[model samples]
Target: MKNDAKTRDELIGEISRLSHLIEDRLVPDNGMTDDQLRSELGLLRDLAEQLSESETAKVLEKPAPSGRVESYQRIFANSPISFSENDMSKLQTFFTGIRHSGISDFRWYFEHHPEAVAKCAILVKRIYVNQATLQLYGAGGIEDFTDGLMSIFHEESYRVFREELIALAEGATSFEKETVVFTLQGERKDIYLKIMVVPGCEETLSRVLVFVVDITDRKDAESMLEEMRKMLIRTSSKSIDGNNSKREG
Candidate 1:
């Protein structure tokens, strides 16, 4: 624990020192010593050199399309978000091709985990948020389906889910994990919702990024895994009891 605390303090100090360095670069002050400048550059250069080619290869796999981040920033700053796919498509300036990292990740997540697409419903702008966009992005359906998912969101649930996001935006609180759940025709089904928020993130990051992973299959697997764990514990206990009985005998 002492080591962990020391490590955490070191990381925090590094971040604080780096922030000061950025400020120092913009507005020069003699507060920073000459050696500090050299130290910082040396550390950065070492970090760059230490990065394995395989890691860079992943980011460099696809060239981000032009004007992606700039356009996205513009839309985020200017538009009243209406999360509909058609409207999102209209924001073509935000993402032209699948070259942008954010777009690529969004595309990958949507296609791979359709259930994750609509999970951002609470935080989404009412105008831009819709089933169409979710479907196009493969983020799953916003509404519950009659065939399997008769899910409905109550007022309290909405409050609990959305309030956290608004609070994060307002700087009242921050969270690493947030969840939303659904009940089908009053019965709890496998459908669930989740989101990740980063309020004090850097310039390249958005305030929040939500994921809707359909855990139906995963939930089933978990149930089986849990049962196995229980069985193992019971067997282990029985074995221990036998060993103790033999020792007593």
Candidate 2:
């Protein structure tokens, strides 16, 4: 079990490192050493081979899923509201660095170091998303969703979200807000979102779970209702004033 856990950790780390490499490639870079790239690639190849020979066999021999597991699977696969899970360790590290630098306000820090904020955006890793999330964003699959993740988020919403994440790292349990997002097809959407930090075994935040509900129609309805209410009030006030004026005459 100890060896299995260690191997799993190595695999996760390598996968995350590879993701960072891909993100780095999106921008101009000094370039990585050929030896370094080859070494990491070799390690991944070996891990994949080991998993296919041993872990795959074990999984194949495992017992069938129980009713509870099936129920959870069904809900995750079929839920109407969109949900996503993000690995937050990279984000936590960024916050830690800022805090140690004597930066108290994230907004000030971001404003002073816009380039750092832009780089930090790449650190956000979307580990999983449900089917509803795919549908909501018009994403064909996880790959499609992640390819344009940064573009999908409104700039202001991204800043707001980063602030909320910093609050979570500082001991807040959950955060919620109504923010704007864009679909893969570039349609703007109003979303009400709730984010909760999932604690690790050591009680630190391991992951962030985001629950998103599209509220565009609801917002439009509320705006129309407010306008109608104001109009009615104005008309009623006018009638009351006319009655008072007639009585005075």
Give the winner by lDDT.
Answer: 2
Worst 10 residues of 1 by lDDT: 82-91
lDDT of 2 by residue, 50-129 (tens): 43464323422342232232333344566666877666667677778888988877766766766665565566777778
TM-score attained by model 1: 0.31
- Give each model's clash number: 10, 0
Model 2 C-alpha lDDT versus the unseen true structure: 0.61
Alpha-carbon shift of residue 134 in model 1 (angstroms): 9.0
In candidate 1, list every pair of residues with a backbone clash. Answer: 64-99, 82-127, 82-128, 83-128, 83-129, 84-128, 114-139, 115-212, 116-212, 117-139
Candidate 1 residue runs with Cα over 4 Å from true position: 1-151, 154-163, 166-178, 187-211, 246-249
Instruction: Indicate the worst ten consecutive residues by lDDT in candidate 2.
Output: 63-72
Number of clashes found in candidate 1: 10
